[model samples]
Target: MAPKVLFVLTSHNKLGNLDKPTGWYLPELAHPYHVLHGKTDITVASPKGGEAPLDPASVDAAKDAVSVAFLANHEAVWKTTRKLADFKGKAADFDALFYVGGHGPMFDLVDSATSQQLIREFWEAGKVVSAVCHAPAVFYDARLSDGSLLVEGKEVTAFTNAEEEQAGLTDVVPFLPEDALNKASGGKFVKGEELWAEKVVVSGRLITGQNPASATAVGEAIAKALGV
Candidate 1:
């Protein structure tokens, strides 16, 4: 049987206290969905369920073919996402858990007890746990069976401080993803040559991608880890 993958998205839609709209990054979800949908059973979920918000600026279908296709089919998937709090499936039922990111995750997933528990359960069960860009914020409080931080001593990468600066939201976001990951993991963070460069790190079954550019590679890494 093919591995089942759960795609967790953020329900938070505001950009900090600015009231600017923001949600999951389109390419971050689109690229990975395109790559893994066929190889694995992909299920979408969010903390609040229903229609997870999309970052307005990141919704350009003209940017890539994957984005175009995803938008065309958005209604079917977006309208039916399951709520993470109400998901009936167990961690063992899925082979992997993927967190899609935008500025939103930094607010909700970072402190979500449900998300933290799920990540811990998935990791402890020997299932793959992966995230991209701001999605890594989910690891902020996740712990292992031994109670050690999940990303502790693990090679990981996410949206960097420089990249946040480039996006000009360094101060707008609650906290910098790279900084949070480094502090939470005792400095096991890594990055690429420049801002937005594609960087995917696979530390055992824990996979991470640096930015939108790294989304597809992150999916490929997850597929490779599952031997699919």
Candidate 2:
């Protein structure tokens, strides 16, 4: 049987204090899904149980073949995502947990108690807990069984402070991803040589990607870790 992977997406559609819309980034979710589609059993989920919103800017930014194919062929998976809370205490059912990123997660998933609980469960179960780009925001408040921050001393990367500024959302986001991860990891957060460079860091069972360009590699990392 293929490994079971749970893909968590943000439900918040509105960007922080702005009229603009945001949700999961298209390529961050689509590229990984495209890579793992046949090799694993994926369960799409969100904080809310219904349709997961897509970041409109990402849709426009990522018009690649993989992203376009995902939007066209996998509507059903994301359109009706499972409620994240429903998976509580059920972490043993899956082999990995993946968080999809966008500006929206910085608002909702970052401080979500349910999300924090799920991350703890997955970590304690010896399963992979991974996220890409801004999705690592979910790790901001997650703690392990020992009550230590999940990313503490763990090598991790996320949408960098520079990239956030490049996107012109430095002041708009609830918190900067790179700064938050660095603090969470006790300054262990690292980045690629340049902005938008593809970088995937695997610290034990935790996998993180630096930006949208790293999404596909993050998925491949998950597949390799799972031996799928």
Candidate 3:
């Protein structure tokens, strides 16, 4: 059977009060889905079974021909979203795992015990575990059973504070991914060119993309890791 990849999404967010958008960014999820689902077999899963949130701010990015066309082709994302509970197998069953990012993740994903357990299982199984943008903050609360840092020595990149500042959402988002990763990883953070450019880091079995622009590149890296 072909190796399968899972796109784990964050579903919950601060309900009411804030006017800010929530959920996975369209480009971050769509680009990787387009690349992986088209190139090889994959599954999309989220914390909540259905109704994955879509950040309203990302709608502009999805206005392009490629993105619009891609959405038009993905009826599953439109109709039958999968839930994480449905998967009965262990993390070893997957070839790779991806965590899609948006402002919403900072509200829920970083503190998820279930997500941390699943990540440790996947990483220990040698699966290609990847994340983009704000999603990398999810690792802040994740730790090995031995009490060692999960990403202590890994070279990874996520949404930088500079990018958050550039977008004028520095305060709108709960926390900055770059700062969290730097502190969580004990100052082992790394980076590439501009925040908008496609930059990804790969260390052994772990893969990370700097921002949403790096989604496609991250997917391709996962594909290569799976030897697909």
Best by TM-score: 2
Off by over 4 Å in 3: 13-17, 85-89
- Candidate 3 weakest ten by summed lDDT: 12-21
lDDT of 3 at 86: 62
| Per-residue accuracy of model 2 over 140-220 as CA lDDT, tens digit each | 779988989999988999999999898999999988888888998999998999999999999989999999999999999
Off by over 4 Å in 1: none
What TM-score would each prediction reach against the true structure?
0.96, 0.98, 0.91
The lDDT leader among the candidates is 2
Cα lDDT tens digits, model 1, 42-83, are 999999888999888898532888987888886666657899
Clashing pairs in 2: none
Model 3, 132: alpha-carbon shift in Å?
0.8
Worst 10 residues of 1 by lDDT: 71-80
Model 3 CA lDDT for position 163:
89
From the highest lDDT down, the ranking of the candidates is 2, 1, 3
